[model samples]
Target chain A: MKARGGVDWMVVVSRLVFSGVFVWAGWGKLRDPLAFADSVAAFRMLPHPVFVSLVALGVPVLEWMTAVLLWVPRWHRAARWVMTGLFALFAVALSVAQVRGLEIDCGCFGSGEPTKWSVPLAWGRAVGLLGWAIWYGWRVRGRSADQ
Target chain B: MREGLREEGLRMAVMVAGSLVLGAVVNGVRSDSVPWEYEPKAQRMSRELARVGIKEGETREVAAGAIELGEFAGMVREKSVLVIDARAPLFYRMGHVAGAINLPREGFASFLERSGLLGKDKSRAVVVYCQSETCEDSRMVAESLRRVGFTSVRVFREGWRRWLESGEPVEKPS
Candidate 1:
């Protein structure tokens, strides 16, 4: 939370944190995509395989891209907004599936056996990440691109 | 502000398009890429069932009935319906819907007779469930029931997770 030379190291660290999370998240799914696709299919939201496959493939990639772009001070706003949108999407999906009484794996990072509490855990993670992205966006506001 | 918005929009769009292209190329080239189109398991199972015939040993897969929680709970209370646990033996032994018999998915392919579940009247109501929302064992087992002439086959689609999460009665073997 310190500032020096027109730069906020805290904000820089925050940016790194966001990027690190996406890198971790993306790495898990990138390692085994078919399993991730299966998790997406389990949600029963996509309804079509094409959509499911696109999401399965695209999501992890988007995550990685966000991770990298957030490092670019100039692109922080766009990257955080994208991250916000993605997390929001996850929150909505998890919420709907829970409402429908679907007991499913959130597949946020990768695939795993879903248990009774997995749904809420997934939803909470989505909401939490969404909040973080918003905060990050706000924290970096009005700062020069280089900082 | 407009210039900033434009830059933001452009960068975001580039990221989106980059993700799309990279995803497609990576997925297409990857040795273990997932299929672009997927058939829902239930539908796939049904197709396999049709390919074999109604009375095949593998059992017919059809969505006969997916009963609600209330109905399943009532059935559990009354012990009138034949409750089937479709998970593995380990999970079955752990805890299951009260009065549920362990009929794991692997057994479905072969245990049509030895399990003695087949001896029951075909018209007797049958309720099947497995691990959680993502698990498909219950559906597969339900299909086996249909193939074996179980007339009142009902699936607790929410399965074991919902039942347990709601504090429904459960059985743990001694």
Candidate 2:
């Protein structure tokens, strides 16, 4: 990330890096979505199987789509919005699970993730990601292509 | 300004909708794809009971000293908890939680006698599991363990189905 001749190269590089994060995250969950569904069930918020499956499948696909769309010049801003919305949703889910005193896998990356991060830590990570998306969105506002 | 905002909103909507449709498509193609929707054991059992015209609470209520899969897996991995299979010998022979002992619900007393578990330490953390939450055997066996002075008995209500689904270790005893 750097500044070069009236173009904020930092913004360009940051967007690229951010898109990779989405790809890695999406692929991790896509590897075993059933296990991901189990992680979704751990939340206990949506006890219905349809809701569980929807979230389990929807989240990763959105992430992958976000990753791909981020590179498209016209779709860049919209992808940022989608990424921001996803993180905001994640923050809410993680916060609720934390407040309910539920001890379960975060499922931010994938199911059966070995790290065992506390719910609070995972919540913090989601909020951090949310902040990044919002920041990028702010930087790119009003600028058309390559923003 | 308004026009640009409208276009962004439309594209965002497209991305989200595309994701939903694609999610189903991907699941349909994958060999290991979960059933379109998972039917939890308790829900399935209740539906079956309604189909048979049997009402709820027809049998004695068993206590739910339930342990979720994450905690149960940890206990199993750590080998700190004594895991017990509440199924019969047939299921036990096929596969079971690693290091778990079989104490069939039907022959609870007889197995208890043969296994000599009565003399074991009662204060240890013990987890009892069966094939599915649809069956009450694990809960009943857990209740029995509690009665026999097992102080820290827990029922892995999700049991073997969840354990297998979660990709936890399974042992087929030779």
Model 1 residue pairs with clashes: A103-B133
Is model 2 an incorrect, acceptable, medium or high docking prediction? acceptable
lDDT of 2 at B146: 68
Model 1, A86-107: lDDT tens per residue? 9899999999989988777788
Cα error, residue B95 of model 1, in Å, equals 21
Model 2 CA deviation exceeding 4 Å by range: A113-117, A145-147, B41-174
Q: How well is candidate 2 docked (DockQ)?
A: 0.39
TM-scores for chain B, in order? Answer: 0.64, 0.64
- lDDT (0-100) at residue A74 of candidate 2? 78
Q: What lDDT tens digits, residue by residue, belong to model 2 across residues A56-114?
A: 77889999999888878878889888888988998999999988887677777775432
Instruction: For all candidates, state DockQ relative to the true structure.
Output: 0.51, 0.39
Error of 1 at A111 (Å): 1.1
Tens digit of per-residue lDDT, candidate 2, span B27-114:
9899857566765434433443444344453223266678999999998899999999988687899999999999866546667767
